[model samples]
Target: MWIEGAKQAGVEAHPWDNLAEEPLPTSVEIEGTTVPVKWLPKPELGESGGDLRNVVFVYESAEPHLRLRWQWQARGDFGPVEHRITIENLGGQEVWLLMVDSLRLDWKVTPTQNLRNVYVEKGADSPSAEGTHLETVSDGYNWKGKSSTYAHPVKDEKREIIPAEIVCDSNGNGWYAGVEFSGRTRISLERNGTSLKSVLGLDPEPGPFKTRLGPGETFETPTVFLGAFRGGPDGAGNQLRPWVRAVLGNPVTWKDPQYPLMVNNSWGSGMQVDEPLALKMIGESKELGLEMFHVDAGWFRGVGDWYSEPKKFPHGLAFIADAAHREGLRFGIWTDWTQAALDTESGALNVRDPKVSDWLVTDLKPDWKPEDFKGQTIDIGVPEAHDWAAKEVKRIVEDYHLDMLEHDGYLVAQGCVQTDHPHGPPNRSTMRVIHDWASDFVLASNSTDVSYHAVRAYYDIYEKTRREHPGLLFEICNDGSRMVDFGSAAHGDYFSITDTYDPLSNRRAFYDTSHLLPAAMLESYVEKWPVPKPENFLYMLRSGMMGWITIMTDTTAWTPEQHEAARKAFELYKAQLRPFIRDAQMFHISARPDGVHWDGLEYWDATRGKGVVYAFRGSIPDEAGHHFILAGLQANKHYRLHFEDGSQPDHEVSGSELLGQGLSVRLWNPLSSELVFLDEVAARK
Candidate 1:
């Protein structure tokens, strides 16, 4: 699997163009035999024109009937290149396809090589101490990372990363790669002698990885993207983020001016929302300038029952949607559509029902009872289960007249104990279950296989739903940040980045995740925190406003002054900050938020020739003012600064002075924030 690299100072330059390599960049194994393949170039490369290039390299093995289609393509002339392998079984007999790695690159380096391996963890349950990890990879280094529908990391275990890796020198000159499958996938980086090998694709763990390809059946590996870069992490991100927006992001969603609309959620009251509370919140949402009203985790008849509670809202959810639309706001509801319970209602999916019981991941205890909201996991890998879930989603959307649908909690299968399912049977001896956070999670030998089938089905369901309702937005919130990866980015509109909602935790999660995703797609739920003062409230509000923001609080309960301040803040976010937030290059201008010192984020849009700095002061009383250096500006340009809070007089300065001498921000109180915006000024004639 090793490929030669261009030698520079006895160390090879990492191959940036993986597709053009001789022989092939990947291979497939049949039974125990490794198939040999050579390139058969095609004459008519479809759509190989300006700003896009597409090519198919047909590879023929020794066997006449077996051939591989290596499709490599890119939407833009620059940025990363993506490719996937298709194993075709054209012969009459079926064959087992095993060990088809998506990408295998061997980077030769010196034994004394000095490089940093950087990756970020999914903020599954909450923000961990090591959200973004950067470590030195030396002569004897081996690192393996995994991603799935949900992230489960035990104590002292290396947390599950976002299925991507970056290996670069101190100068940030290196290559990065990631997988585009929302299933059980992995990336590994290992260094031995002069070989630093990386393999990314489907994870074949817990033993025998096998998928059958009958005659005329084709199996495609998960697509992976790889790119070489010269700048550091931020530099890598600047190039990667725009490419993702163009290639992976939905064009229909972006065409809406308020794509990442402001949201006011009803979770501040927890699961006790009634019709009166919902109507009240809808009124307050309009007065506060929020664009959407979200009803969370309540309003349902029962667990697994998708009907509105008759007592809570006698008129059903359609009535609530009509109210929000009357106020000119979008209405979204939360659902765990794949979860099943004991509800005996006519339309409810009861786990104890004879047919539904078969789809359950495991046999429930005789006396098992369902939580008020949480329920048993279903194996959507089964065709019957998949079809039922798909139909249910479309029905719910139409019945409720929903503008958006948010799926929370574990809605996908990561592990199962069913032998009769398409993922095949699990080794019952290896089957182990743990009850955590009010649900059972299975672990078996075929855990990866179970996830593979379920994720594909999940993608299929969403694709079909999108085709039917073009404007419907889908939110991927696996109990808050577990499903934050490239695959979900392609399928869903935005991600709820964390379960914790404190200002510090919100900033921490945003800091870690914004490195690998677009700022407009990362949702930070600003829950009701201790905002004892107006400035503290602004501080809390601005913390999550850096990305897609959702305020999960009762705006009706705010004092008059707080309400006035929030209205102004929301107006400012919509008019002055959102454009930069949506299309600017983000930088961590200060240290990560510790709530003890000053911290901030900088957004500079070179195309717009303007940007803003969101600065915050911490609890330390003595550190009133902090100096900050900025990025993504011209050194010789003159800039005009405007302070949104007027903490300081509006002024002008040279970009060199701002970048080198630093912008000074002074705050008289702790737990306060300021927004300082800057734009390019005309040079003196």
Candidate 2:
């Protein structure tokens, strides 16, 4: 299990060799097993004609979960030649994989060994205390540190080195995703947990030179490392296969110690407190171990302005925050800082002080005054504008002792006018003006509370805000699952796969997408929006328990069944919180493109020890044994399977039977899934 020059099975050693060309196709001997190694023509070299084939060398390790890698070019004629190394394995055990932490161009290799001079938190007075790439000689292999986006300028500069990166047993359990670009070349990685993975070729390349393989029996751990030059998809297919397999094979684990999922109330204007309804919901949420209760929109009468309507609650807005605190649940309020109703009846339109006149809530037309204003947008960039906002919002937060802010609606402000009064130039695009306004608002308001925001539209705007606030959990809702793609997910905490679907039917799609992209995606929604349904809430709460869950119901409209489901869902949610946040690994079991019976697997707390398995069925209006495979299981373990009672019947199966046997099964029940738990087993084999 050890390497010839290293003490551990996971050590990597690359001693720079001055030799021009060792041999045509050499071999790297590791643990007494030699892997074939050779170099091909690097496409980056612009070869008029030659082998055109890049280099590839793979070594079989003695350990069940290891592979050795090495690559270099022998064409001495191409001075300053840069060779790309890529590996692919389609097997049960994963290889300890890592990329070269440097950029090689024009024969000059620049290591990501020094990042202190490259990264800086944009506005920090002191040298930003952000994570930077620092080179280390561990196990004799030089390693570079990975930098979080917050600490860098992020200009997408060429030839510039990116920060270091690492995927450990804790960070990436089942699969991982990352992007690497150095002014000229870019590499992206996406690992599928199992089956039909590939590795690609980069140099001397017009297209990817792929290697497709799997375990001795069936393909498991489909990994891919998509490589590209100048950052495009020309070489994607080749790199994608191996990259996915490598990630799937890597160890899966995380540390989610506390389970604290809970039910929430958020609806249109969404969460206007009825005092009585608020009190009941808060108490129920607490009784069910729900740690948080979010009071979504409608509490404030003004959109751009922040103030609670005493008439709506009668007891005062502070009463609800206080009630939530008394019940030991964290309290959150929604804020759409960008738009304001200009209607004269709205509380937001009366601020006309001459000094702050530029911040006036004027409509596009003169007849559109606050009292009678319709569809008027506020200009937040004028210093006085945000000044007005902060005073009102701070009062609410301070008085309520709020724990989180559900920030929403910045995208709606992009095209609104900022008035011709005086803040720089007039007629500026709403996009530019609003960006400045939003950034200022977040910076001016700092109470050390957790805040969540919505980036419903506009990808670029969401990315900008994300860069500014890494701790902030941002949700991207493109209205439905069709918009749920890789491009949108790279920048947010979770993607609400589908909106406003009946939970029982829609949960399958949510689980399927979560299974497809676990590392970078999660399921979410404002449960029961537009209408309240127990089945919808139940399904959403169940799915959310495994990942990210949000609920939006008319507290006043809950039926007896809805109430019970809410209570139980809150409990299950709390139980799943720790795992959901930690090692939430998902492996796909089945995918029904026709919306028939969808199947997938999700395991929370896979990294930090004990875990729970979640399986789901698509819409089924018949009786049939719905069957699917389970993943993230130990070969020697015993598992007991449970369903959602009326949702499905209970069942049991051995982990060895579901995953180790290389066999698939079916159930007579329709549109349902089985939740499996292992009672006893040895450490992972």
Candidate 3:
């Protein structure tokens, strides 16, 4: 509630009554240069003395749910900076932190101790090949491992941080960095040659670190940094000041890379397009402003069949490629490079074939039916295998003039299972087999406009793809949020718009996703599978804006209404792009277990001087009183309000009136609705 460090900085308490509507502040001045700070909440004050300086930033918003204060403090500077961040539970009930980032790249280390609580490996040769195991301290927490050296460079090796790039300006003058670590959820630092720009961070820690809470108990963790240079010491505390400001100011520039939107056709039917159908799909996609149209499975003949199934498509794969190109869209094709369907007439296994052993599964039972045959996986690690893949890929690229290569089912492998393959020894860890497989994939698929795939394991694969191919885009498919960890979202080029298994679920899935992921990573289907109602269409349109919103249906089947809806969704999504995707904080206001009642999420954009609060009824049971209270509204300015799905008509009010008196949104049997207010809404009197 009280900030002890600000007094040292010659600042005031900036009481709640006088606090700004935003959670973070804009424009903080260190030394002389005053850069913009995005959002500022009131700070929490604690006892300060004896070398410890404490500062807390509190965000109060009722739209999504309640008020939360993020506390950051500096204490030990035994050469390097050591800082601790505390997430105080201003709310009365218990909450889940869900995600936390705590890495600071500025601190150079001969070896570092990363915060990984669990480690699972298939065998000795796996990447989880560490000598030590994570020791459990409490039920949900484990002690940090002692710093250890690695045989080679590991990027986010523990799946703790997001994908971060070590980019040097054209002259290699500037270095922008970001990584996740313990205590602190994420730390991003931007340094241009000399002056250390502001550091930014976020704290989703529900309570104190290590100690899980019981209703009102708190959880906190410290994000530490150590370095040397112009701005000052790279101590944890010093590194924190700028980062907290960055989190608060909501800076637009992120050193981490951004990915693009892509439309895939795997979830639906096969892609051996029925001539008339393929042509129709391409035409509709171009009309809907589609970018890449990927033709999924059924193209190749053999499981390891590199050739087209001429029977399925009369003209062969080249026809589809030419059609996509003529339609003003890039042609993308799918490859099960690491798989041999085993059903293709000539798809039998042989020791001579590099992928043969990898595809053969002695693990299969004699009683197993044809469909029950445990699928065979290929060995992509073998040199000859790599060459085979390269030659096959080269043929497709050359013959079809393809713009992108979609690698799928490259996940399941058998040759490298337990037997000796062309690559190495037997009984290898699945992870290593996959990692090595990924390395070869890059070489095999890299010579194109985009090299994308849907992977299951190895988080660094996203970084590898982006690093090797700067302009490349990765379509991450990890079954909704299974592989959708903080590190993946932070570093991957793009999020898979939807789970491959369930394409229709994304409409509601988008709400839960908005808590952390960006809208640019979402995907949708424009054409009707079951025919999304107008309300359902608006739901997807509203939430999909957080990432890449794409249509995944049979593009050829979009009706007149669906076409218009797609256009509307895209336009609306682009309109909210600023706060929804770029440099904005996604606040989870409320929780809905049944997902039937109104669940809320708020987006604050310090750059645009605007904010958006979204609320939706997951599933309604009985008519219960559900109200959404808004807290970030500025005082003394007139604001307009309405629902995204047109459930609530336009209403006007002043910020001052809603400051202490938050907006209480009440709905009866509501399906999905969004309330939008202009920047003037924050100026309300």
Candidate 4:
């Protein structure tokens, strides 16, 4: 497939055989006959113009067995090209799709021997050492590990793997690719002489079941994005970032106050939040200049039960929402809408009750009793189930006067084979239901439809609710950062990076996540547990300022000085960071912290001609200070620098000097941080 935007970016294609291997680019079996597919150029183009264009190519078997539509889309003049494959069963017989690669391409760029591949290592669940680690691809170092085992029995026994985004960069230019799926994805780059071949697609671990497509049935593959950059890794990141934002749609596109400064009552009160405590937090949050107060978990009676806990909120949930509204703050509540606690009596409403059983997608173990189930998964594919969920959401928002709903749960719904379900039987893929619902919802609301299966349900729920309750904000938190992908961002207003309180982890997450997500849609929170000292607390607070800031600590427990400091910190973030975070581009300056080095990132909005650099020194010993060139600034304009930590005197430097000669700073103390603000100085008369 040819991408016009990519060609405009000086990229050229090579005539290399893309299907000369043993495992075909796409394999399908119909009537016990395997067919070889060949790509044929289509007459018409897909979407075009506005920094993005799509060119589709069709692949069909020599015999009339199957057809695959490859839609290759390009973003911006030099941005990435994302490709998604759609397989359609052309014959009347049922077809079994064995494999379909999301990306398969060969290209020849400006030749250079200094090229190196880049990947990231996502750490385990442990708090102390958990972080996203970047590494260069080298020989004998397979990022996905030697064995491709899928879903091993032992959770911690899996080999170390990297994230989906991969980059092959020379000193001057680079090539980047990323699989958009949130689940297991494989990306590989191979060099043969001066040419490069890249392969990326779903890495479906060893599984028994195969996708079955009947006559005229189609299956769409997860998208794989590929692009080339003129600069190094940063340039590659820049190329991918906008494409992702365009695909996901910006937070501002959905609601006002695009990047909200939220105070969440999660870590502060845990699941024991009461009306009094919630009201108190709302007041404190308002005083701290927080725009939203989110009551996370425990607000409802149970997982599936949307009503407020009578003992905890005797006056009902509306009381808390009313209090927040009176304080001039938006009220938000959290729920795991996908699952119901098996232990609660309400679980019967989702599992045992005949009227609702068809509404559930929970797959029981062989011969297991319903009472033995730990959690009941709701089958949104069922029309009744979908309507019930929408009603509950509307009920909560209307009754509580809520402005936001934080949807927290798993991503993919387990396949339901029950024939009684509305969307069931042979095609158990929940993706179909999601697509149908989303299409209908978007049409009903008169909104443009962005076809992303993973977030379709989320988009439907959010759009349907917001249609009635205008200005409703939706947050997607899939048990931490597991589902932090374009699909989630497509519907969610903002995403919580993780639920952990570890300051270091949150800081490192901010650095890595910023590479793919815009700062406005990425949120970081200061943890309440194991509270840090005043300076460290400030560091934690500052770390979160790189994106949307959320404070999860109990204000009542803080001393008068701490409370005052928090208020000051919130004010500082609002004054220094909020103005730019919504539109500012992020540039990483330091490496991910290993506890021995200073870590930092920069947020610069070239239009505003101002930015902020946030740097932190970990506990371990290394350097007393660090210096790095600031990015995204006007070279000829003079800039005024202000220090938040008072470690440096106010100074003036030209943007050329800041970008070329670099800006220097010293923290002096370990476990400390500093924020450097840079604004273009007014031209002298």
Q: Pick the candidate with the highest TM-score.
A: 1
Q: Where does candidate 4 have its weakest 10-residue lDDT segment?
A: 440-449
Candidate 3 per-residue C-alpha lDDT over 172-214 given as tens digits, one digit per residue, 9 for 90 to 100 = 1222223232112333333323222223233322212122122
Tens digit of lDDT per residue, candidate 4, span 389-506?
7777777778888777776644334344355543324333323222221111111110001112223454577767756665677776655554555545655677776556466777
State how far residue 635 of model 2 sits from its true place (Å).
4.2
Error of 2 at 406 (Å): 0.6
Cα lDDT computed for each candidate against the true fold: 0.83, 0.37, 0.40, 0.61
Worst 10 residues of 3 by lDDT: 444-453
User: What residue pairs clash in candidate 1, if any at all?
Assistant: 409-479
The lDDT ranking, best first, is: 1, 4, 3, 2
TM-score of each: 0.93, 0.50, 0.53, 0.81
Over 4 Å off, model 1: 1-52, 60-65, 91-94, 110-113
**Number of the top-ranking candidate, with lDDT as the measure:** 1
> Higher-TM-score candidate among 1 and 2?
1
Model 4, C-alpha of 218: deviation from truth (Å): 2.9
> On a 0 to 1 TM-score scale, where does candidate 3 land against the true structure?
0.53
